[model samples]
Target: MFNRFWSRFFSSESSDESTTSTKNSKPDDKNSGSETEMTETSNEIDFQLMPTGLKKLLNKVDLSHPPGLAGDICEDLATLEYRALPNLRPAAAMMILSSVARQIENPPYKLNLYVISTALTASGKEAHQNYLKQALMDLGLDSKLHDTPRSDKTIMFDLLYSEGCSIYVLDEGHVLFRTALSSRASTFEKNMADLLLQLKTAKQYRLSGNLKREVQEQLIARLEKADKKKSNTAFQPEDKEKLKNLLELTNECIYDPFVNLISYSVPQNVAFLFSKKEIETGLLGRIIFVRGPSKRAPLRGHDKVVRPSKDISERLKAISTENLPTESLAARTTLHTIKEYLECDENRNHGMYGAIFARGYEQIRVVATLLALESKEIDQSMVIYAFKQFLNSLHECETHLSTQSKTSIEESQKLVELKVREYSERHGSGSFGVIRNNIFKCSAPIRKLENNQKDFLSNTLQKFADLGVLIKVGNNQYLHKSCISAKKLNTAKKQST
Candidate 1:
């Protein structure tokens, strides 16, 4: 039966079969040329490995198992490690399930794989249904299939608890799973919020078996620690204001599911459209935000022209599966590290990660996760370069990067002037205010101030006072030249004598 399924699958060839065959036949003719081309291409493709230092740091983590049932569970868990493979979704799923099943002690628990499709089909006549059936059979789990559709919750739960079923697979499941889980008569916004929340929670908690419960407990503990840290700090008024704004932005992104807002919109508009209350609550912080190319954007030359390349796709599939466990652990570690980093006021001033989060939250997270995974396996410089490239890609989609650069330059200049004036006033013999005003005349560039006359005047006056040329004796009243250098006074006295 397996042989029949495999042969049927491979025999049904697409139009590219002839091209593939021709390429295989001519392999020797261009072997040397292609090999050189491939080497250059391989060098060009960016593949950052983990740093040795990071690897040594990670090695300190104790991955060893404990005794008894705990040990047994850990041992069982080890067999279920299936990394995601490229361009081989069905095969990857099959491998993951098979590994999971092998770890179990009792064979009585049935595993049913439920594959969901986004397309609507009225009957079994749909080609997709046949395709799914074939895929299941190819995986050698055709007998485990439940004939009933998953749209019905009662049927789903029953199948889940049923003694005959063990593993369930859902293919192309976004719409179907979302619709089934949604509350009847709920607003689309509410449904989306519910869906995202459920997915996040499930991703954190759900596993092949009892491990789900253990993972949930660990998550709860982590949350508790985070909550305690938040409670310990008292925010200043400015900090409080910023936090309030950030929270409101987060809420809008997370809860508001208006199709127009969620599907395709500018980040600023998306942030502004959210309800003010939602932003204050910080619900958006929970989301894995992503900023990718818009569907409407024109394809680049590289993307627009594509030739059949099975070898490329196959190689990607193989590469994708190489570091699954490492990637997963790295993702968790990176998230926690980022959270800590963002919480610090000093680190916030650094602004690289913050800028990425503001523009491309999801992409930054993915890049950070990948970097964490590779931190141990690659050179430090290579890892840093890869991270910079990831950040650059995110920055390219948004205008924030240019703005940040300008702001940094302006702030640095202001700091330099302020520091020089402060030092001169403290020790120099000249009138501090006069020196400050002269310095301002020499160095202070004109600013295009709008609706801030009072602030502008205040800053100007402060600069003079810092230089010791002027002193404010009363409200809005200034005393100039309170004291002059002793050299000038001595010369006047000597001339009079």
Candidate 2:
């Protein structure tokens, strides 16, 4: 029903805008249709002609009687024209909503989203991040907020500290992930990406550090100390038993870790972040991309953000990890259907469309849960609004990637050959003891990296070994032709002399 209403609303709105020229002329009674016919014509709405995206949806919403703080906060940002794009404000708001609301217990899956927003530099990404930070601080939920990552372990520590959920809203966060795309990408970057993926779907991820062993050791020391001081009131018989039991359970790590990362970056930088491998691994599909305009957006003269409604503030304040609303069966079914439909597109067709749709149904439900607030059941209106955000996000991501050229990607692929040549030069033997840092030891420039070189920096070397230009010396290393027979090399030099 909401879909029909949306379709008709857009159709009627378009007609009104297009028919403005007819208003000045006299009405033609003969052409004017009956009221029933007019209603039928409006009902026969062409969905293809309907204008979509969050801005159009924002314009139609009335936030007085708020569904939840998510939509209301978006409306507030939109009203102030918060110097962010039409979609980014809500993306931030949803991040806040999901982060704060994650404390809500018993959802179909975790309520948090892996969302990324991008725009041109000086396009207010930083300013918007500050605004979001201030908003979170205003609600007294500052602990959940984190800055850019200093190390790979920083996120794990953040999740450990913030009750298993941390929100990092970094302005140029893509730079960290971009390193993982390079051939020289460190284990740390790859591990970071892997850790994020684990945090996304799996509940109760265990920390492998000495946290458990250290706690157990401490517990044992306390027990032995209590035994040494039999009279000490600190360790009674019952307390000893409790301490022993606690020692048994100290092997625990993060249980139900809710980690949320919302990054804002430009399109070019983001292009280097994900490749086809990342897509197949489900990382690309899991991420929600909200792309802003190619240029900065103009401010609406208001220097400050309009404060959100009292209910929104109060509602946000009242949200706790243990007090979130539970999802209804109707909500679950709709979300499941959405997931299947998106997965179908992914299986049948191709591209990053499935990537956005990968989280589509789940994200929509998360938004709906925000809009529904205390009303746990999913409704048609809430689904429509939530779907609007999803479609806008999809459109933004698709449009953003569309701007990335195939020529540039072809160029990135050329790095493989460069890396291979680089490997041969750095490890191969040369006549002089000096290292020719910029020299290519290989006579021919290959178009791709070999398997050994790609992983262990030895890519395929058997062909060179077969040609006698190089010899396989085990451990994925190659003995240079000069190294194979220094006597022959010296004799050749002697002949030249």
Candidate 3:
């Protein structure tokens, strides 16, 4: 059922290439102008390689291709290869690998991939360590992947001294983004930023190997002391200057060390998970969104479900390697293409696309992430699609959940009315309020006593009240007007005549 929904949701759309570019470029590029140039380089390379692999994958998968590439165009395609296949881990991994590859191919300015997400932990750092080892092994790269579980300071020191370690993958990237924003000088983010600044100003410092350590330690201590003093009171002008200096230093030292980071989750999940400030600072943009169907709902009772000739794990590994992109350009292109397809359907109010389309706030983060992955020149059309897909998913969840809630509410209302009527018949009209209050003690509507009792009560007393058969006294008190007739002597005298 979900497959059918997703198909109709994604398949029925046509997207124009020109339209895609316009919609994906809203985020402010705060990075220096040089960063923009690097992104352009990345885009040029990606556009060249994307079509062949994309066409092949589209043909292999049953899903509909983005509009304009009809079935006929895709049919003849054989094996399409994503460039970063061997190194591509998940969507996030691809983003990092692609960025690094782009930098290697076109250098002079350093590139950084910031992997920002909600949380990070060192408890299972070994798993990532092993994964990196396996990744290096698979690539046949003659390098040992070290599992460095050191303090941020030590790591920075190691990075400074380590020669030929051009790619520094900061696993659990969200931590760094958080630190960068932290006000505390002693925080890892501040320290890391400081280290980067030192690296950039290497020529300025001109210290020998051992002297570099002393200078770094001295600088870190000075920053820490300054941060502590600021914590006690408002940041004095000097302190503020120092903080800004530290930031600038960090930025300079990093020299654009290719910082590749990625996170695997739904776009909304990432948005809700990260702070607004982080998203604004392009931290969110660096993330690459990789989406796949939940494994919980596997296809069942199909002939294809039978044991495959190859090992399932091997098949999955092969598929992941085959479909994944090795370079940033390819990854960004794939993301852009998929985003376009999702948005096209969403604009037309097709399937879950509407849910994503309607949620504008989350859409921003999703689009920003895509833009970051695409080297920060996302088309406006892409942003619209991100929103549309987000809204579409939200709409589906809301529709299903709301329908159940409505049904339950209706049932409860019926039950409440039935109980109110039964209580009224057993007790009496004057006691309607008391009965209702007792029956629905916690219910605000019943407790408020605003509605006419006649709707829920069928007894003659209630019916009479509805027909003006009762007189309302002070304090919501009611008395049957017919009782007054017997007491009136004029009425009695008239009857006798």
Each candidate's root-mean-square deviation in Å? 22.6, 14.9, 18.4
Error of 1 at 250 (Å): 30
Pairs of colliding residues, candidate 2: 103-321, 104-324, 285-355, 450-459, 452-458, 452-459, 453-458, 453-459
Worst 10 residues of 2 by lDDT: 28-37
Best prediction by TM-score: 2
The residue ranges of model 2 lying beyond 4 angstroms of the native Cα positions read 1-68, 79-84, 209-250, 305-311, 318-340, 343-359, 391-405, 408-446, 449-497
* Model 1 regions more than 4 Å off: 1-189, 201-308, 320-341, 346-497
Q: For candidate 1, which ten residues in a row score worst on lDDT?
A: 29-38
Model 3 — TM-score against the truth?
A: 0.32
Better-scoring candidate (lDDT), 1 or 2: 2
| lDDT tens per residue, model 1, 1-497 | 22222122222212222243221122111111100011121112111222333333332221122211222222332222121111112222222323223222222211111111111122111222233344335444454454323332223222223322323333332333334334563343233343333332221212223323433354455445555566556634544444344333322322211010012123332332122222223323222222221212121122221111343223222332234223344445544443443345432332223333332233333323222221223233322322333332222222233343346446644554564445445644334345444444544342322122234434654655555434433344333332435665344334434
TM-scores for the candidates = 0.25, 0.59, 0.32
TM-score of model number 1 = 0.25
The candidate, 1 or 3, that scores higher on lDDT is 3
Residue 251 in model 3: shift from native, Å? Answer: 14
Q: How many clashing residue pairs, candidate 1?
A: 37
lDDT tens readout by residue for model 2, 125-171:
66567667767777776888888765456666566546667888787
Predicted structure 1: lDDT: 0.30
